[model samples]
Target: MRAITISEPGGPEALVWTEVPDPEPGPGEVIVEVRASGVNRADLLQRQGHYPPPPGAPAYPGLECSGVIRAIGPEVTGWQVGQEVCALLAGGGYAERVAVPAGQLLPVPAGVDLVEAAALPEVACTVWSNVVALGRLAKGETLLLHGGGSGIGTFAIQLGVALGATVVVTARAAKHDRLRELGAAHTIDYREQDFVEEVRRVTDGRGADLILDIVGAAYLPRNVAALATGGRLVVIGLQGGRKGELDLGALLAKRASVAATSLRSRPLAEKAEIVRGVREQVWPLVESGAIRPIVDRLVRMADAEDAHRLVETSDHLGKVLLVR
Candidate 1:
């Protein structure tokens, strides 16, 4: 087997593709022969030694992948060897083979290619869990999403639209047209405009019913200010640093709430529940052509460093894949 290992984490160059021992499935797990893996900001964080894999997870850095099952472990059932599936992982997607918990596997949606399926699991589960399950974004509500051109953001935009919510996003000006095509009702250039004001203006001063933010402390005050009465703000990443003062008075006045979450460190049962929800609710939208994979480009598995570079630069529109 071959996997990308960090040769002392620092930069993309630290991700070294090298031969490694083959992974064997443990109880309730399955071995997947990876066909492709999606590049994420987390991968870059891991490479820079800022984020480490969870306890007992593979040292390699990847959060999602698409592959065929090679073997199933004890206590696992309903999935078989040779079945094509995409999986959400805590780590180790940047390898030719990975051992995955059975609960994390999702059948490839109808009409999606196996390689492209690699792009779905992480984004799907994240959006489904936060935007739908936690934020409770409903029809006629407005969602303001930061990093709209990102993998999770792109998926969130489409899913919000599919669920009948009005979607607004913040991204570079050049990406706005494509985002609008993906069902974003409005796009704000985060570089040049005040997203809080733009979101307010777009919603007739009502503010967003839900704001899905990746930027952390840097946007906290503005995010709270941009929320509608009784709105929810779900923060999934801390790209903008970690600490910030909260305005309890503002939150109390609007009856708004804020939650910060990460999928990688969650317990297995919770991840299974989220994956199940995604399969039942989100997969249908994908199969029906209401949502599709947003891949910026594909790189060979051996050149994962290049993929990481692309993701770090934020030059790509959606996911950057490392293919076998």
Candidate 2:
């Protein structure tokens, strides 16, 4: 097998695709012959030496992939070799073959092809867990999202719309129209417009009932101000600086809550739970055409360095996939 390995983390050039020993299944795990893998910002972070894989996880960078089951391990059931599946992986998606926990595997959603299915696991589980499960996004409420043109943002937009919430998104001016087409009730040009003000304006000054933010400390103060009474704010990414002071008085006045989560480092049992929730609640909507995986483009698996360069530019909308 061949995989991308970082001899010394630095730039996209560090992702070297070279021959490596094939992975074998362990207890409650399966070996997947990779067909496609999803590229994410985390992959870039890993390549730059900022993030490392969790203990016992593969050294490669991908967080999700679509593949065929080549072998099943002890204690695995309800799955078989040759099944087409997509998996939520701790690491190792950027490879020809990977060992995956059986619990993290999902059948390819109906109507989605193999390569595109690689786009689902990470974004779907993240959105479903934060927005629906934690934030308790109810019908008839307004949901505010940052990074609206991103892979997670696009998926969240469709999910929010399908769940009957009005969606408001923040992105650059060029991507606003496309986000609106994806069912965002409002779009803010974060480069020029104040998202806190825009969100309030679109929601008739009630503010958003739920906010999903990726810009960490940079947007913390304004995010609190943009919340409605009893609003929930879930922060899933820290693209901005990490530390910031919060106004506890403001939060108390609004009776709001704030939470932060990292999906990659979660325990396997917890990830399995998230994956189950996605399959049960999100997959039906996908199969029904209510939501779809939005892929920006596909690059050759051997050229992962090129994919990393593109992702860093933030020029593409939705996911960039690496295919065999």
Candidate 3:
């Protein structure tokens, strides 16, 4: 099997393509012949040594992949060799072969290409866990997503719409038109406008019912300001520095809740649970043509560095995939 490795983490140039031993399925796992892998911001963070794979996970970086099952390990059933599936990974998605827990495998949705399926798992799980499961987004509620041009943001917009929320997003002006066509009821250009004011004006001073934040500390105060009374603010990333002061008084006055979580460090059981929820609630949406993965570019596996560079530059409106 061929895999990309980082001998010393730094930049996209650090990714090295080399022949590696083929991975074999372990008990309750399946060996997948990967066709495509989605490059995530976390992969970039891992490439720079800011984030390491969780304990007992593969050292190589890849968070999600789409492929065919080549073999199943003991105790795994109900799936066959050659089944088209995509999986969420703790690591090792940048390889030709990856061993995934059977519980993590999701069948490629109808009308979706097998390779494009690679883009679904991570974004689906992230949106479902935060926007749907944890935030309890309800019909007629407002869901605000930061980084509206991102893979996760695109998914969040579509899923929030399909699930009956009035979706609002913050991105650059260049991306707002596309986001609007994708079902964003409101769009704010974070660089040119204050999102807090824009959101308040658009919502008639009521504020958004839920906010999915990826900017981390830099947006904390604004996020607090954008939330309606009793709203939920879920922080999923800290692209800005992690340290920030919070207005506990404001939170108490509004009876709001603030929470943060990352998918990678979660225990296997919890991750499996998220996967299951996405498979049940969200996968069917893809199958029914209500939603699908948004792929902006595909590069050869050997040129994963280029894909990483695209993601790092924030030039992608959707996922950048590496195909083997």
Candidate 4:
């Protein structure tokens, strides 16, 4: 087998594809022959040595993948060998083969291409868990999603609309039209517009009922300020720096709450539950065409460096995948 490895994390040039021992299934796990993998910002952080794989995970830099099952390990049932599936992985999606927990696997939804299915798991689970589960986003409310052109952002837009919530997003001007077509009711150019004002304005000064933010610190104050009374703010990524000042007075006055979550290092049981929720709730939306995989481009696995470069520049409208 061959996989991408980093000896000394530095840049996109650091991702080296080389021959390695093939993975074997562990208890309750399966070995997958990789078809394609989703490129995420976490992969970039891992390549730069800022993030490391969890214990017992492969030392590669992918968070999700679509592949066919080659073998199933002990204690796993219901899933059979040779099944086409996509998986939510903690690491190792950048390889020719990977060991995945059975609970993390999802069947390829009807009406989706196998390669494009690679884009579904992570974003689906993230949005379902944060927006639906934690934030409890209800119909007729507003959902303000940051990074409208991103994989997670694009998926959230469709899901929010499908659930009857109005969606607003922050992206560069170039992506606004496409995001709007994805069901975003309004788009704000985060670089040029004050998203706090835009979000408030679009919701008719009521503010967003739920805010899903990827930019952590830089937007914290504004996120709180833009929230409606009793609104919930979920921060799933720290693309902006890690440290920032918080306004307790504003948050208190609005009775808003903030939560920060990371999926990669969570316990297996928790991940399995999130995956289950996604399969039960979100998969139907996808299969019904209410939501679709948004693939910006597909680069070969051997050319992961190029994929990383594209993502680093924020040039993609959705997921950039690495295909076998």
Candidate 5:
């Protein structure tokens, strides 16, 4: 099998495409013939040695992939060879083949191409786990999503809107129109406008019922300022610096809840639960076209380094896929 391996853990240039041993499925797992994989910020961090894979995880960087099941492990059931599946992996998704737990596999939705299904697992699970499961965004409420052009952001906006929430997003002006088209009731150009103010204005100063933030500490203050009474703020990434002062008084006054989490590094059973829930509640939405991944570009598998570079530059909107 061929994989994109980190040469020395530095920049994207360190990614080297080379042949490696084929992976065999372990008990309750499956070996997938990877067709495509999603490039995520976490992959870049791992490539640079800033982030390490969880215990017993593969040393490779990719966290999610779409492919066909080539072989199933002895303990696995309810699946077969050649099944078109996309799965959330602990690692090793940048390879021609990856072994994944059967519990983390999801079928390609009705209308999704196999390659596009590669973009679904990570973003869908992230959005569903945080916005839907933790933040508890409900119908008729106001939901604010940061990084509106990101893979998770695009899904969050669509899901938020489809669930009847008034979706609000912060992105560059160039991306604002697309955000609106995706069901954002309001779009604020974070570069030109104060997102806190725009959110407040659109929500009649009551703030938002739920806020999904990827900016980390830099947006912490504004996130608190933009929350409605008892609002929930879920942090999934730290694109900005990781440490900052918090307005304890403000949060106390609004009775807001601020929590941070990561989809990777979670226990397999927990992730499996999330996969099950998403398959039940959200897969139908994706299948019916009410929600779909927003793919900005697709690169060849050998150019995984370039995909990482594109994501690091933050110039592209939505998922950057590496197609096999």
Candidate 6:
């Protein structure tokens, strides 16, 4: 088997696709022959040595993939050797083969292409877990999603709309039309507009009922300002920086709450639960054509450096995939 290994943590150039030993499934795990994998910002951090794989996880960068099951381990049932599935992985999706916990596997949704199914697991679970589960965004509410052109942001926008929430997003000016087409009620250009003011204006000064943010420190104060009374803010990415000072007075006045979470570091059972929720709630949306994979482009697995570059540039909308 071959996997993208970090020769040294530094740049996209550090990701080296080289031969490695084939993975064998352990108890309750399955070995997947990777067809395609989603490229994420976490993959960039891992390539730069910032985010290491969890203990006992493969030393590769990908967080999700779609592939065929080649082997199944003991204690795993109801899955076959040749099943086509997409999996949520803690690591190792950037390989030709990966070992996945059976609980993390999901069947490819009925209406989605097998290769494009690679984009669903990570973003679906992230949005479903945070935006729906934690934030409790409901019908008639407003969801403000930062980095709207991103994989997670794009999915969140559609899901929010599908779930009957009015969706607002922050993205580059050039991406606004596409986002609006995807059901964003309003789009704020972070480079040209004050998102906090725009969000408040769009929501008739009540502000967003739920805010999903990726930029951490740089946007913390503004995120709080853009939240409606009793709003919930879920921060899943620290692209801006890690440290930020909270305005206790503002948060208290609004009765708003903030939570920061990461899927990669969570326990297997927790991830499985999230995956199950996505399979039941989100998969139906995909199958019904209400939500679909938003792939910016697909690069060959051997050209992973280019894929990493595309993600870092933030020029692409939705997911960039690495195909085997």
lDDT of 1 by residue, 102-134 (tens): 999999999999999999999999999999999
Q: Write down the lDDT that model 2 would get.
A: 0.95
Weakest 10 consecutive residues, lDDT, candidate 1? 306-315
Q: Show where candidate 5 strays beyond 4 Å.
A: none
Per-prediction TM-score: 0.99, 0.99, 0.99, 0.99, 0.98, 0.99
Q: Tell me how far candidate 1 lies from the true structure as C-alpha RMSD in angstroms.
A: 0.6
Error of 6 at 316 (Å): 0.3
Q: lDDT at 160 for candidate 6?
A: 96
lDDT of each: 0.95, 0.95, 0.92, 0.95, 0.92, 0.95
Clashing pairs in 5: none
Q: Specify the poorest-scoring 10-residue window by lDDT in model 3.
A: 309-318
Worst 10 residues of 2 by lDDT: 196-205
As for lDDT, the candidate ahead, 1 or 3, is: 1
Task: For candidate 3, report its TM-score.
Answer: 0.99
Instruction: Output the lDDT of residue 12, model 6.
Output: 93
Candidate 2 per-residue lDDT over residues 69-176, each given as its tens digit: 999999999999999999999999999999999999999999999999999999999999999889899999999999999999999999999999999999988998
- Mind giving the per-residue lDDT tens digits that candidate 5 earns over 1-324? 899989898998999999988898899999999999999989999998998999887788899999999999988998999899999988999999999999999999999999999999999999999988898889999999999999988999999988999999998888888888899999998988998899889988999999999999999999999999999988888988899789999999999999999988899999999999899989999988999989999999899888988998778988999998
Residues 1-324, candidate 3: write the lDDT tens digits. 889999797989999999888898889999999999999999999999999998878888999999999999999988999999999999999999999988888999889999999999999999999998899999999999999999999999999999899999999888889899899998988888899998899889999999999989998988999999999999999998798989999999889999998998898889999999998899888989889788998999899899988888787898999998
Worst 10 residues of 5 by lDDT: 54-63
User: In model 2, which residue pairs have backbone atoms overlapping below 3 Å?
Assistant: none
Measured with C-alpha atoms, the lDDT of residue 38 in candidate 6 is 99
